[model samples]
Target: MMAIRDATAMRAAVADSWHRSAAAGVLAEDSCAPVTVTGDQLRDLRDAHPLARVFPLLDDVLGQAARDCDAIMAVSDEVGQLLWLCGAPSAMRRAERIGFVEGSNWDERLAGTNAPGLALRLGRPTSIVAAEHFRHSVKQWSCAATPIHDPIDSRLLGVLDVTGGDAIVVPQTMGMVRAAARLAESELARELLVPSRPDPGTGRGRIAVECLGRHELLLSVDDGWGQRGQVRLSPRHSEIFLLLASAPRGLSGDELAVLLYEEDGGSSTLRAELKRLRDLLGEDLLVSRPYRITADVTGDWLAVEAQLAAGDVAGAVRAYRGPMLPRSTAPGVTRLREGLADQLRSAVLHSAQPDLLSTWTRSVWGADDYDMWVRLRDLLPTGSPLLALAEGQIGRLDREIGL
Candidate 1:
């Protein structure tokens, strides 16, 4: 339904306009500034201030969602720089996985012409596949973009996208984008708007959606009947649940398949899986047919799989509380587990730009980071110029604040 053409002209228009905005100072530099603190800042709060007390709810929420949506999606600000990703080893190693290596801006010549740029321009969901984008550099990559909105008022928040090989063109991509936006939207609301309510039903049992600690979400389900156990889905399912659970808008079958990779089979097999999930859960699920789904739908396995596959990682994670393969540990479960972990790690560890700097920093800190400190260490090296400069800055900060 979308057209691919005239990338050269489009690229020229975008570049000219971008330069004009920059020269005029109409584009805010702070817009690209991290809406966060480095890991060092958190460390200072712990060691120096103790009660210096700054909360990192947004960062955690973003981290968890990044982990959940690792399979087919990634997150970023209005610009096309990547903040999070899944299903790739590391952004540095992603020339083949993402079709573009790390740090390639959606607006830069590196990307040439791409959908991420167009989506930012359009301020809504848009797609650009191979050959249609402005740059031949990324002609092989397919992208789906969805703009997140402010909660309550529905103002433009940011954007979420999914990109990969030409294989990236799938219906579930829309669901992935929308679902991510929903989670981000929810966090924005919880931070800037109203608290989300617990919506529970009789036959469907109880569904409690809460701000986990302060940032990430925790969807705890109690069906009234049976013991109350948390759903423990795999990484792929967690990503899928996060997408679907945030659905004020539902997704389609093909769309869900793309996000969750269809749970070890083709789309038709996925459909069957959805039905079984629905049948098991009863009238607790809803389907968007060709597009989306939610927990409130009739939970036949087909519907279940559809919702889980479409970015409802929260639900799937919860549903998978038992062994990925309950009766036995099948090779299928092993493959699925590896996939899920990779997806989760992708979202949380990668920086917004997924640059060489980010990859190196993550590798250093991820093995053992409490939170933001790794980023602070990144500013310095052992006995290097940056290290000395950073130590001086820290000293100054301590003196200024009387630490």
Candidate 2:
């Protein structure tokens, strides 16, 4: 029997992982991570996972960067089973050689020492350079990973990882992964903080309109069946939908025209637009007389308001992606957007939780929010690393205003 190699030369964490892998009979020489779930089984688990809700957010934040850097970004469940992977096609092909494909279990006991497994095992951010891995095949690759947790009850949700060559082992890579993990957790918190009212009586399932920061709205609907799908709403249709949804009593053609158009006597044009909307949403959901959605509906802006009302200041900040229907010049939408933004900013300023505050400062909507930066500066502890970032932003904003 080959004696277990002396682990004195290894980092303490890696040594412990190696010891555990050996005890578990993981063959470091040429073993591979087991395929824990596949086909429909993997799809079902991913669909039901909380991370599924935030996968797009993670992809937006880190996917392009990973591709640009010749790396692949991977997300795994709390049990270390990889669910999704995105990056350059070449990088993905390279990763597949090492059995890093979706549905594979990379738990420390199974995959030996690896960044995602180590991070999940230690419940923190972890980086493993080439050769730090107990699995000989994975020695040529390096990775940085961080565990994402549900900010509500603090359950371990999953791990977000970037894997590639030596470039991925840098401290900045680790920092970026950690930041992405936090953003994912914040988004998850935002979802959990706001509870949507179910329309059990109507059995219409759930309808959500995502209108923040996008010209076209994304309409996600879950039918009474388990099936779910999304449709993109045009700017005019989205404005009409938001107005109708917000108006409990619904809006007549004349009322909608005023809110939807800048000029008077646009009711004829408004009627045509509503006709198109009716076709898209089906005639039953979009009724006449006073046009309204008969089905129960919720939206991102609504969720933000819900969080704010529940005193979840952090969640409100997270859910406030940007102004509602930003490109829409409709009087109703503009007013609604400004009002919701003001509420969130006021709450963030008054509540002043540093993590959420930092989240706000980094957002496109809040990048130049001088008052918020000042509030964040005052709120951060002196030794806090983010203190510098907050102060720097404050100075930048001050210079812009010629302070």
Which candidate has the highest lDDT of all?
2
Top candidate when judged by TM-score against the true structure: 2
Q: Estimate each model's TM-score.
A: 0.32, 0.55
Instruction: Give per-residue CA lDDT, model 2, range 1-403, as digits (tens).
Output: 1235768888899889887666555667754566656897689668878899999999999998899999999999877889999998998998887889998878776677899999988998998999888888898999999999867446577899999997776789988999999999888877754644543444455668887766767787655444455667888888988899899678888888888887785667788889998888766667888888877788888999998999988567656657888888999888898999899888988885765665566556786889888888898777554454566666667788999
**Model 2, runs deviating above 4 Å:** 1-206, 222-229
Q: Which lDDT value does model 1 have at 76?
A: 47
* TM-score, cand. 1: 0.32
Off by over 4 Å in 1: 1-72, 90-92, 96-104, 108-110, 152-155, 191-403
Least accurate stretch of 10 residues (summed lDDT) in model 2? 195-204
lDDT tens readout by residue for model 1, 1-403: 1123333455554444334323322222111211222344324323332111111332343334334444245544433444444444442244443344223344422233345555666676777766555434445557777776545434343456666664557787666566656766666556533333544434445444432111222344555444243343433343444445544476566566655553454877766666654544343443445333433422222233454457654333223221222222333334444454344334333433223222222232232332222344454346331232233334444566687
